[model samples]
Target: MKVRVIDNACRDFKNIDYTEVSANKICYRWQIFLEK
Candidate 1:
């Protein structure tokens, strides 16, 4: 199945911190770098 990543990421994101963020963001960042 396909994922509306940004929307799902936003919904799933729970933790937010200065040093780091939720797992969703980390996954997206990896996708952006790897996909690009």
Candidate 2:
């Protein structure tokens, strides 16, 4: 899958805090990124 890495990092578009994000959510975001 193609992943979009802005600033050479994966992040949750809706949430600004990376520390609070779960691994599953990050994986989900990656899926969304691949779909885009």
Per-residue lDDT of model 1, residues 1-36, tens digit only: 124654455455543442235565665775575556
TM-score of 1: 0.40
For each candidate, what is the lDDT? Answer: 0.52, 0.53
Off by over 4 Å in 1: 1-21
- Taking all chains together, each candidate's TM-score versus the true structure is 0.40, 0.40
Error of 1 at 18 (Å): 12
Instruction: State the weakest 10-residue window (summed lDDT) of model 2.
Output: 1-10
Which residue pairs in candidate 1 have backbone atoms (N, alpha carbon, C) closer than 3 angstroms, thus clashing? none
Give residue 23's error in model 2 in angstroms.
Answer: 0.6
Instruction: Candidate 2: give the clashing pairs.
Output: none
